[model samples]
Target: MDRPTRWTRATVYPDMWVDPADDPRNSDGVSPDGELPTLVDYLGRYRATLLMKCDDLDAEQLARRSVPPSTLSLLGLVRHLAEVERDWRGWITPGAVPPRLYGSADGDFEGAAPDPSLVARAFADLAREQAATDTALAAHPDPGERLGADGIAVRELQVHRIEEYARHCGHADLLRECIDGRVGQ
Candidate 1:
């Protein structure tokens, strides 16, 4: 028996919102040129992609779960990434710090709700953590430099963050498409 082939509407717009040649986001402007710059660029792109997925959505839409028995939502993704950014920052620059952003539990996802305030706070926290992480890395240019008590390499931390953002961005794509008919690659 011939199995049914699967096709996705996600690629219906092969250009992905705009012609590749005219897309400003893909433009390699006067941005820095180096390994660090490349890694940061990819990570930043994924971060922006996630936010784009959450665009045009109200708190309720964002907080709506895609399927039952799962806590996953656009808002939850934002909160979880905020927590992840903070954790990665701590790994690279652990020191006298303030209290936890949302306590030690799974507050990130657990607290994600259909509240406008929570949505705003999650975005703010994500931006703050990402900036701090960049500043910390800039102060220590050596990617191979061991950091914190564990002596983890800066490269490992940076790579991990990129991977984290990439993974979540994929999830965001699915969640957004489910919320609306909008789809992309």
Candidate 2:
């Protein structure tokens, strides 16, 4: 029986983006053993993935919407994630958190206009917030450490962060593909 073989996103490439030896996100034989390392490693990888998805794109491409009604764009995700990181910093640290990066409720998405300065600012904010969040998290090494009045464990929050990044990275994958038809891990 003769049949046609259709190439899809999955079967299109056994190795999605690049060769294993050349993949920057590769663990490089340093396997994370503890809960903290594992969670942080995952979070870092997802963060890197999102940045990689946005790489080489200009302001217009980065701000391009996924669909007509949806405001899901790579730049928007970056801003949203920056907001999330800032929020997380507020939770973990005992300092007065700054106001939202974008003033409006939907500013993260709606405010992601296709401007070169806005794109630069968004990436800069993301990096700054992520570094601050990482530093705050580092101060409390114990997984069982509680945060805020709700008593959410540091471990739990870390897991939640990983989940958040994972979900958004998926969105980023789609958004990037929509912009340039490039697909991979």
Candidate 3:
């Protein structure tokens, strides 16, 4: 069997705006039942799509800034997502605080650079943080559980995660296009 090719920003998209299940509508087959898993599934799919868009590019390409003064890059987005996941976990997991991955607060955006190693590290950190968040969510399925001192509900956090992924995925589309001619999601 042939091995699956790694994805890259230079690669043309197979299709655009389809859900993870390959359905035409982004929300198709999301979850007819109710919230909970539906929200998690949507957010997870968005996060996966964003990473897929970045797949196979070299660290240099991943770290390439969109434009001067923007400091936005595929790597930066990955790093930022790692921070977001960690932050959410910290809020929800009570006393199970995990140390920040990108140094101090705002470090994800602050420490971003065009360095190859930094880019690679950002991707790795994202993977780790994502795994931790999934584990936390699985361990606590109740959507009504309050997260953080702000008293945000688990369901609300999941919804916020979906919003975060959608917004960043949109940014990823533009950044990937800027890096190369490849377009669509």
Clashing residue pairs in candidate 3 are: none
Which one is best on lDDT?
2
Model 3, residue 35: C-alpha shift (Å): 1.5
Pairing residues by index, what is the TM-score of model 3?
0.78
Clashing pairs for model 1 are: none
Highest-TM-score candidate = 2
Give Cα distance to truth, residue 51, candidate 1, Å: 0.9
* lDDT scores of the candidates, listed in order: 0.76, 0.85, 0.76
User: Pairing residues by index, what is the TM-score of model 2?
Assistant: 0.89
**How well does candidate 2 score on lDDT at residue 108?**
96
Cα displacement (angstroms), candidate 1, residue 32, comes to: 5.4
TM-scores, all candidates, are: 0.84, 0.89, 0.78
Worst 10 residues of 1 by lDDT: 1-10
Order the candidate numbers by lDDT, best to worst: 2, 1, 3
Residues 116-150, model 2: lDDT tens digits: 99999999999999998899889889999998656
**Candidate with more favorable, higher TM-score: 1 or 2:** 2
